[model samples]
Target: MKIKLEKILNLDDGEYRFHFETAARDIGLGLTDYEGHEVFDRPVVTDVVLNKTSHIYYVKLYAASDARFLCDRCLEDARHTITGEFQVAYTDLKSNREVYDSESEVRLIEIHKANEITLDKDVCDTLMLEIPTKVLCKEDCKGLCVQCGANLNEALCEHAVMQMNANN
Candidate 1:
């Protein structure tokens, strides 16, 4: 979604809110999407809070969606609800200064001569950061047996259990 800040730039200092949506293509999720999940293809809801604070634009982004992934332990289908929040600062006014104020502490984006900004990259990066390093179907998921290659959770293997007890 592209948001035009031209009108907001002309207005007096204030805050504004805008709601936008994006498809997989817009967020660079067309191929090898976020964690290789097809669910990212669905439209993602994005909320932007634009606040004008002391001539600086503070942008707060919120995105939420459900993603599917393969469980690492049991090799089963797993679903996780992902919610990401990000903050950025931008100034529409021209500035020749090389350094920005340290108080804001957000990545500064130059949008002085631009009428709109596309949030596709931001959304993609936010969601990508949410991808878990390890995926699991459950906290106590019992994985498959090494000896017989059987699902330990579904059926207990007598030999496997005996071997574990003996080793302990």
Candidate 2:
């Protein structure tokens, strides 16, 4: 979502509030290609504070999302919740034209006469950070049987034990 900051940028001390909802699938997070695999179904509330002297824009966002992931253990569909609080500093491109370091965390956006700003990419990034590297339905999931590919969560297969004993 883009917000016009004409008034906020002009003010010496300004507070701007934005509320909107954006689709997780539409954004280019590259989380999943399957439709409805991951959905961000939460309201995004952003508070922007501008410091005209320093030409800095401070933004804070509170966002949440729900995603469907295949559990690595059981291979069953699991639902995961993603929530994040993000704070970022943005400088006006016209006046504060400084090169950013390769490892700099701060994101810079070029501001022209157009006072529009996009929060989509920032929101998506925050959500992506919340995703866990490994997903499991339960902490102690038994996983699938290596021999027959049977879901161990439901029941253990005797063939798997024989296979393990033979290998050992």
For all predicted structures, in order, the TM-scores are: 0.76, 0.68
Clashing pairs in 2: none
lDDT of each: 0.73, 0.66
Give per-residue CA lDDT, model 2, range 50-122, as digits (tens). Answer: 3344566667777676677888887787777777777766666534535432334444555555567677787
The 10-residue segment with the lowest total lDDT in model 2: 42-51
Q: Can you write out model 1's per-residue Cα lDDT over 33-150, one digit (the tens) per residue? A: 3456584646778899988766677788998767777778767777787779988777644351224545554544466556676777887788878888898889888887777777
Best by TM-score: 1
- Model 1 stretches with alpha carbons more than 4 Å out: 30-41, 96-113, 157-168
- Alpha carbon deviation, residue 148, candidate 1 (Å): 3.6
| Candidate 1 local Cα displacement, residue 26, angstroms | 2.4
| Model 2: lDDT of residue 32 | 61
